[model samples]
Target: MDKSITVACVQAAPVFMDLEGTIDKTIDLIKEAASRGAELIAFPENWLPGYPWFLWLESPAALTPLVYQNSLVLGSEQAKRIASVAKENNIWLLLGLSERDHGTLYMVQWLISNTGETVGVRRKLKPSHVELTLFGESDGSSLKTFTTELGVIGALCCWEHIQPLTRYVMYAQHEQIHIGSWPSFSLYCDITAALSPEVNIALSGSYAVEGQCFVIAPCAIVSEQIIEQLCTDKIKRNLLKAGGGYARIFGPDGSELTTPLAENEEGLLLATLDPASITFAKAIADPVGHYSRPDVTSLLFNPAANRPLSIKAASFIELIYTKQIVLPGSEEVQAN
Candidate 1:
């Protein structure tokens, strides 16, 4: 007998920078997915409290202390509220956000079980070069999975799915239901032109097919309404009018299994997962199992790549000391 699970790929045209609004939107999507018999629901990245646009919009001058004004923590009170919605709906949830951890930020996706247990978090192993201007480091500690009633669940945020080794880790853990969460559609932004409309699902499908897992991929659509509210700049408005991206899902073989929702409108598409696909696909070539040959060449664990801050603490401290003379209230002098 084959096991089946209904999954939803929700496309939300999030009103940028509005935390309360995004959370409410997510809660509504959760209800809709559940109503459609979805056992697992996935959302686009940075769904809660919204993606801070200062970096993307080049508006960082608005920074302040109390709010950190730059980054907000992932497990913050505001996000916990979204987690509650997942629990209340009684479905496994995979949501993405710019996770704030203390003063540092990481592009992250969290897997929450129906019972509201935050089982595991998969951070973007390597932030895109420009993304480093805002997001923080993702270390080994954040790579893991959570056992859920529906199946073993895991997640990855945006481009991290492009990293072969990163995708290998999830495959190693034997994840059944993989959530591929994307950011709000960023089709024409000068910075994100490379992340195309077709690439979102195409790449996501490659991951599902390659990893032998069902991928519930969700992405945002840049709608006329959200554009009207957030695109005050003429260039930004024109970019949105051009087009955003689509949210979609794939079977274990990486085949498109559902249709995308309307732009700027929020909705979910539900489909069941078949475990046999993984077994059948893996028989072709399991990247980690019968397909791999450690004897040929070993895979390097690049600690520095993922944990730069943890790796450079003393150097960072030295840099801080070098700037101390310019800081206020420090008498021109003493050495420790």
Candidate 2:
């Protein structure tokens, strides 16, 4: 609603495998940012209970129970409490978590309004490489933008920003603010030759340019404390050594709005974004409108939410009375 809004990116690691501890930390950060006039605040991917670096060190079987115990479930008391924090602070909250649903866990993000209501919930469309083994992939429904009082906001986790079609999808939705959530780059640089913090930063900047939207990229840092707490093995500890934090904010014109925090700093990166900038940028090139070639190319998008199968009672009477129906041939057998 304001001409300029102060947005913040929280770059910090979580208390590994400690759900309650991480939630408390998140609340503290949210309150601190809100006190400093941050209207919209976003956290790094898997910020709650931290990223599963164990996937790279330990086998899937070895880490399954640990992850399940730490990840959050939708509508749980913890989730409600987090929403209450947003309402109490009167700030828009965009938080990332390792979500536990039924028997599966997902890399999910929640957009909470000032009223403390969850406006949108999106899961990562596809987890990157080894992440696929730990988190479940989201459907097209998760690829969406929401209309908020501030503006149209959308989000994608880590490498999803580089997915050409995925980027186009957000651009087409006219997202004014895009949340880019990522784990530590230290996890990537050591494992692969090409991916690093520098490469990821460049991608984020370019994404702002291409999408013509302000980007709030919040990257997590692997601290020595975290390493000491989780990585008992020398190899694992070395792999997760400190300093990967790179929380930043980019303008609609693809300019850096704020200097990134030090690789090891645990704090919020805040930037004031002028709503007029989006108008100016779109006037030059609106990808969804003036710059798009709808006739030449078109994308088929589905917005159906996924759900598990359930058997329901045939009628309300059956449900209320606990009545059972018997088949014509099998009179003794009842199906309730």
Candidate number achieving the greatest lDDT relative to the actual structure: 2
lDDT of candidate 2 over 1-336, digit per residue (tens): 246899989988788789999999999999999999999999999998788887776686777788899899989999999999999999999999999998899999889998899999999999988889988999899999999889999999998977899988888998899999988788646676446888888888888888889999998888777777668887786666677888889998999998777898889999998988888898999888998889999887787877667666478456434546454676355444
For model 1, how does the per-residue alpha-carbon lDDT over 55-117 read when each residue is reduced to its tens digit? 445454342231244333666777688778888888888877766676777777878888887
Q: Which runs of model 2 end up more than 4 angstroms from their true locations?
A: 188-193, 308-336
Q: Least accurate stretch of 10 residues (summed lDDT) in model 1?
A: 63-72
Please list all clashing residue pairs in model 1, or write none if there are none.
19-49, 46-96, 46-97, 73-100, 74-100, 105-136
The global Cα lDDT (0 to 1) of model 1 is: 0.71
Q: Which segments of model 1 are wrong by more than 4 Å? A: 59-77, 189-193, 240-243, 302-336
**lDDT of every model, 2 decimals:** 0.71, 0.87
| Leading candidate by TM-score | 2
What is the TM-score of each predicted model, taking all chains together?
0.80, 0.89
Clashes of each: 6, 0
